[model samples]
Every structure is written in structure tokens, then in C-alpha cells.
Target: MYQIIVGIDEDEAHAKLCAEEVVGMPGDGSEKHVTLIHSFTDNPSGASATQLAPVREASDVLDEAGIDYDVTESSGDPAEAIIDAADDVDADLIVIGGRKRSPAGKALFGSVTQTVILNAGRPVMVTGVPEDA
Candidate 1:
């Protein structure tokens, strides 16, 4: 079974969606081990506190579905934290949320998802959220 690591961000809706996708992944008829990972920055003024909530919500769903998973929390740049977590668990897949960034923003500071997609040695999945979310 594939070991999946879903990258969770501060957005609840995006996280929930990613979690759902993880829960729905076909197990090749075998049970897959999933790891829900959320990264937070040291900046309390930021959305760090809410970053891991999605994993908690996702955990409830996994529990109800009888799927097995472990949740992890880390502090640092989101991309780095996610990569590190995946490595820690030897994950076969890394799922993350995708966002649209302004041209200037993308040029000045690369998006985390972009960096992860470019660098993660393992397979990665990117999911988008509803427009209202």
C-alpha cells in the first residue's frame, strides 16, 4: 500500500478537501497508510494556530472511515516543514493545496506549493479549494 502524506495549510476548506481526497485514494485493494501533515510558523500573529486544524477535522473523517493515519505538526517555512515531514515518514505521496499568486508575488517570493512540486522527490498531489473558500 502507498504511504500518503497530505500537506495541510491554514485554510480549513482546502485542508478538508485534501483530506477527503486522501481518504478516497484507492488502496490497490489494500489498506494504505496516510499521514496528515500541517506546518506552522513561529509567528503567532500569522495563521499558524489554524494550520493543523484541518488535519484534526480530517482525522475525524478517517477515524469514521476506519482508515489509519498519523498527524504531525512542525514549525518552519511551510515547504520545508512539509518536505521534512514526508521524509520523516518515508511517504510515497505528498499532497498539498495550490493557490494562485500574483505575478509580482510569484516572481519576488515563490509559492510554497510551487517549490514543493519542483523539489519533492516523491509523487505530489495538488488540490484547489472552492472559489468562496
Candidate 2:
């Protein structure tokens, strides 16, 4: 049995699509448990509240899929929190939504996805956001 963990940013549309992909995966749903995770970066200026929208959207997706999952919120660097959660759960796989960025943009602001890909012990599945979403 595999424990699948999906990282959701709280974007309802993006999260809905991600949950659909998870549920629609070619496997027995009974053999897997999906866990949804959300991380908030510690912004001294209090930027964490901005994450509610995406997290809510992600939760809606799980609800619609009828996949019982756990949603957690944490305050810290996003990469660290996500990695910690994956480790705590001993997840077999991780799914995350990413926004594509140019090389310059990536260099200027390193992506959490990239960091997780490098450091996470489990497989990571990254989904890209559609232009319209």
C-alpha cells in the first residue's frame, strides 16, 4: 500500500484539478491514502493569511473526490514545512502544484518545488497551472 501526499497551495481551481488527477490515477483507491498539506511562510508582516484561498480550494477538491484526507497548516519556510510533513507521514509519494517561471525568475526567487524535489526522500509529482487558472 502507498500513502500519497499532495501539497496544496489553496488555489481552488488548481487544487481541484490536482485532486482529480490523484483520484483518477490508475490504481486502487483502497490501497492508498491521500494527505493534503499546506504550508505558510513566516512573513513577519503577516503574509500567511493569504494562503487561505488556495488551501480552501484544495480542500474542496478532496471533498468532491470523496477522498478522506488530512489538511495541516504551519508557519515557517514552505520548503522545510512540506519536507517535514512528508517525513512525518512517511509518504510514498508527494504531489505539488507549481507555477512555471523563467530562469531569471527562478534564480531570483528559488522555488519550493525545486527544493522539495532535491531533498524529499519520496517521489514528487509536480503539476503545472494552466494559463487560465
- Write candidate 2's Cα lDDT for 29-92 as tens digits: 5666777777765446554432567666666666676667767767767777778888988988
TM-score, prediction 1: 0.82
RMSD to native, candidate 1: 3.0
lDDT of each: 0.76, 0.74
> For model 2, where is the 10-residue window of minimal lDDT?
42-51
Per-residue CA lDDT of candidate 1, range 1-133, in tens? Answer: 6788878776777777777777778763137777777777665656533345676777776776777787777777889888888888788889888887787998798798888888888888988754685
Identify the runs in model 2 with alpha carbons over 4 angstroms from their true place: 42-51
